[model samples]
Target: MTGTETLERPETADKVEHFDVIIVGAGISGIGSAYHLQEQCPDKSFLVLEKFDSFGGTWHMHKYPGVRSDSDLFTFGYRFKPWMSAPIATADEILKYMGEVIDDNDLAPHIRYSHKIEHAAWSSKDKKWTVDVVRLDTGEKRRFTTNFLWMCQGYYNQEQGYTPEWDGMDKYKGQIVHPQTWPEDLDYKGKKVVLIGSGATAATVVPAMADDTEHLTMVQRSPTYFFPGQNANELADLLRAVEVDPMIIHDIVRRVALFQQQEINRRSVEEPEIVKQELLEGVRAFVGPDFDMDKHLTPKYRPWQQRLAFVPDGDLFKCITDGKVSIETDTIECFTETGLKLSSGKEIEADIIITATGFNLSVLGNIPFEVDGKPVNWPETVTYRGMMFTGVPNLLWVFGYFRASWTLRVDLLGDYVCRLLKHMDEMGVKQVTPTIPDSLSDMKVGNWIQEEDFNPNYLVRSMHVMPKAGNHPDWQHTQDYWREKDEIPALDLDTEALVYS
Candidate 1:
């Protein structure tokens, strides 16, 4: 910070860096956009503006002890790049993979690190968007113009994590930390550690720190669905052993994984008993028959009501069986001098506390957007294919499927944007917007999330900030991958749904 404040900056404060298309992030989505831009639109000039000093958005931000993907790499990894390592990859591996992609694709020249896009204004007369960019160093501001704006910035607040105010939190003398902003130097070796919350983060941290800490405890208000999966995928290993090309292996393995995910998701809702018994039996095998699974594993709601947390090779259960970890399924009444006290009068002693709570969802990078001098009201607008917003011309936001792998939809989006630009060029059109009929105008505005029954805590907290959806499919955002897969690619550009200018 001192060096930043004192050094002379290179990016001129008032200079504008223009491009044909301007992407707002350098995470997985943004990088994929760049790759597709190179592959599909070779002549188009573009720039990727990253807010952080480096790439790997979520992976780079959360540097806690156990930071790995809940979903395996078969689908989470890009279809273009076959993930050949362990099916479940660590944060470091993902970061390295991203860097390799950028290097191999010669995308480093197009990236502007430490550049944040703040606001954008569109002019109908100019038929172009004027954007404001801010440099994190020296607080310099600049302006740029683009014919199209691709919002690849991810859907959560990067700077902060959601931590509810617990009673008597100030009295705890030990160090308290949040996983979003973990300190590199904070040591937990041989120290008692208690992680609060039963979400994916807490599940990940318990097993990761079990061997390092003197004792590890997971505190949860209620139980969440846990799915124990094999760490190594034999299918991938066998495919590689038989000398199948990695890309072909990726194609087959990705589909197999997706189909498996879809089948499990279906049964979780339709045949809950089958999934419940299968999952609990895996736990019971490790924890023994005498263990009280009703208190620690059973949830009142059905499976997939919230996200199903995954632990590879049953690592979390291994920790519990090894006597290195314990569970507290109760509410925290208050924080004592050293640890938290439950409402049931149960006390947990800890030297360090990690709040693996959740995230504050963000829509469109929290940027102020204006078209022809009028502010964009998202809730008043309807979404098109969960990507483009009605009345917003040539602006597409890459929001992937919630239940499926995020990259699956984003890969489609990158190609779709390229195709859209080409189609506009062919038709001599400069702008396009989704148009809804007057009959749908007065339709009841409901939550964008149709499956409210599958409510996660983070989505419940931040759904208000997102756009609304009506009853129609064209007006609503569907979370089904198969439906979107068949429908989006075959969409007609000349249809009445899109108005060209």
Candidate 2:
């Protein structure tokens, strides 16, 4: 509480709290950032403001059957924490791990739960940010002032999921649901279900509900790439048998996983056909030679273009091989009273329809922001390494990697931000802003992320609201973790890209 103070507002009887730093969200990134701040910047007084009642932003919100991580937990889990569970983990498993972090670090006291941030304003003159938040539990409006802002609210809308409009949706009789806001009362037992979309969400749900449903069908406009493998890590098992330290085992396994991922990503660009064939072969090994790989498994896009879902034990294919599930690759013509009518005139009859389309992408948690009395339009601001933006001072948003485990960047960025904060103190600077120099002002700026680099429906749909990125590596949020791992640590704080005052 060295830099923190509480003052009574003269106008309203409300109290205003001030701190050295204010972090938004209490999810994986937020929790991990707190650990770093405590370990690296112990002198700084900070608070975590979470809108939800508890932790686990995505994991807590998603309650769909068989909801789990599309990526493995080894890379997804924090580097400081050793994940002793399976490679793939359920929502509950992730939440439990996050809970352990909170308890271990005593982060609960630093986190203000049920605090929804409505507006954030930065003052250049004061070199501080005034944030207006509402306590969701009591509807109490609270004002907080901070020297720095750390955004970890994630990239997607938690309340409303993306469900495409189809004709006759209102006319349909069955229950329609999205995985984001999964209804606890959704009773799909013995019901004929048609789940839309071919991404990870569809892959997770179809196999989990197949046994309980009368008949389950997966309807996708196009196929998506999936890597089906056994859930266990053989190296971890071997290391554990020899009585190796859990922390050391975690470190070794994490590096190995990252190396393998780098190779795959490199090949996906350098030799996409080879990588594509390897992925297809992984799926073919489970579905047998007779299965229609061309029609039901192969995607039109190359490997690594979109997210590659990891299917544990080939569970989805197992459901397909057992004839418990069916796949239809066609455009949805419209919804019938009973089910959906396809462009090929194939009608899928169902009692329930799951629009596992995806989530709605959010820019800076979709919170209205004002900087020095000017409204900040996200689309107009060019990014600085995807963490900081032009004209924005003393703010860092945790926008993670798309090709690799998101938490990989979280760990990397956590270290970088901590170091940056320490560097600012050494320079005796109260405000630091990223500005495009006169020489680089003419640099070509594009959408926050390049569609050609990585395009998912959720991201493509909200490109208009996302921040802009420059063509240069330093000016954009390079999704490549391999490059950023080395580049970020070596970034010169005194460079022309950042202006410190």
Report lDDT (CA) for all predictions.
0.85, 0.91
Model 1 C-alpha lDDT per residue in residues 201-308, reported as the tens digit of each score: 887888888999999899989988788878998999999999999999999999999999899889887999989889888778778987789999888777777888
Q: Against the hidden reference, what TM-scores do the models get?
A: 0.95, 0.97
Give stretches of model 1 more than 4 Å off.
1-12
In every candidate, how many clashes are there? 0, 0
10 residues in a row with least lDDT, candidate 2:
1-10
lDDT of 1: 0.85
Q: Model 2, range 293-383, lDDT digits (tens) per residue?
A: 9998999888998999889999999999999899999999999999999999999999999999988998889887778777788787889
Best by lDDT: 2
RMSD of every prediction: 4.6, 4.1
